[model samples]
Target chain A: MNAIDHPLVTAYLDAVARETAELPAERRAELLADLREHVEASDARDDDQVREVLTGLGEPRTVAASALSEETPAGHIHPAPVAPGRAKLTVILLGCSGPLLLASSVVGTIALIAGLALLWGAPRWETRHKVIGTATAVAVPVLVFVGALLGAASRIGPIELLLLLAFSLGVPAVGATVLLRAVRR
Target chain B: MNEAGGRVPSQLRKGLLEYCVLALLRDEPKYGVELVAELSAVSVMTTSQGTIYPLLSRLRREGLVDTELRDSPSGPPRRYYTLTAVGLASLTEFARAWPLFRDAVDHFLTDPQGDPA
Candidate 1:
């Protein structure tokens, strides 16, 4: 029965989260957490008071806009950093990981881990980039491993294998390319 | 009932709001809700009171402020934001410069007839 648990309040917060999807994770989380605490502390005992509290918070999109605008100098926001990508090695590891991982080699595993470590550590790349890089990097092995198990049990077909191969190559390629362009932006 | 006229965002206040926050913390630290309440009290400076947190976050990131968990008299421990030395310095600088800036702005507002004195 807490005011914050009201549907309207939840919707407003959800909208804020959706609109601020581009912010750095910690900043976005802190904003939402603060807002949650704000709502909780408002002591809105009824629907009318809850509505008033939400009204005082303004539209979620506006709040998100204000938060994003604060991050930039010219009021123009970029989804990625403006600095050139210095994580070339990370890109290389991710980009080439598909073929490396197909062999199930220990070196491939090492390279994948290194690529992810570097991707996360690279300050120029935003968290989204790191996430994409990580997901794509990890996906290669997972897909291949599943494909290998299925291939052994003879449950997978040639078409599926071919498609897997294509994804194994294409997904990481696209992920790595997106990361390159992101940092280059 | 969401009313569109409920709040007005003062765009001109964007750059100065952080200084206002610094001023708010000048005397003592404040929890999140308390800060929001004080800020929204000003009609011109009001917007989504929640937006202040991001500004506060940036201030902390920039080493202008620091936070600590303090036990409150009621509900739960609140995170109290305290102004750092750097924050005080920046606030002092802003205080020193605001009057000159305000006078310049006021002169233009009061004398918009191309007066050059």
Candidate 2:
């Protein structure tokens, strides 16, 4: 009934321990101890039950992978690369949000929010680009509103108003687009 | 088979099996074999009973479960796993969230229209 008496059980435990060699020593010890206890206590007198027990435990590699996943981040378990198309779409949306702001305020606001979310969520963009995109998102609108207010107070021409809107929105929009291109992976 | 054969069930079991172990220890401390037997009896919850050892090791590392060695009546000294206060709190939290999550999945699967009603 003891694991020491059963060569198969000892071999199985040894295999599991070897597979998990890279794990922390304390954890590896615990795992081996648990397996050894389970095998020794099992009432499997026949070779069939022993085989079943081993199979139920699965291959050593599979067990090791499962244990590794527990230790690492879930993202490490599955490294899903972002598609180039998605990255391109993010760039396009981020650039368009500026011009969209001029067309219709409500639609532009929705587009701007969506673009910012895409920019922030995209794994392809570096932190710097994301920050620039966010800063541009906040700054462009405030500058435009202030410019429009000042132009109105001075009784500026319609041409001046249009020019102010273009300048205020255009500068950051262009800058952000360039920065995004520069920092993209 | 899909690209990852049997991966769906494996992934689901991976996420839920630790909680199942915590739930098993809710009433009393159990030795590793007893826990494996209970889980294997459920069948769907586990594919390989031996894999539970690594999971138990994780629970111990996470401070959710504690183990103690005791003299057994028939064989070698047995290690019994008991739920810690942190483990009990985690199980309670899972109990609260499981129903809402199950019902949401059920609704999504049953209602193709994605209607809230």
Best model per TM-score:
1
Question: Model 2: how large is the Cα RMSD against the reference?
Answer: 14.5
lDDT: worst 10-residue window of model 2 chain B: B1-10
lDDT of 2 by residue, A70-126 (tens): 666455543233466765666666666666776777776787787778777866666
Docking class of 1: medium
Clashes of each: 0, 1
Candidate 1 local lDDT, A10-76, one digit each (tens):
9988999999998888888888988887888888988899999988887898789888877775855
User: What lDDT is reached at residue A56 by model 2?
Assistant: 71
Evaluating just chain A, the predictions reach TM-scores of: 0.50, 0.49
Each model's Cα RMSD: 11.7, 14.5
- The CA lDDT at A152 in model 2 is 63
What is the CA-based DockQ of model 1? Answer: 0.59
Clashing pairs in 1: none
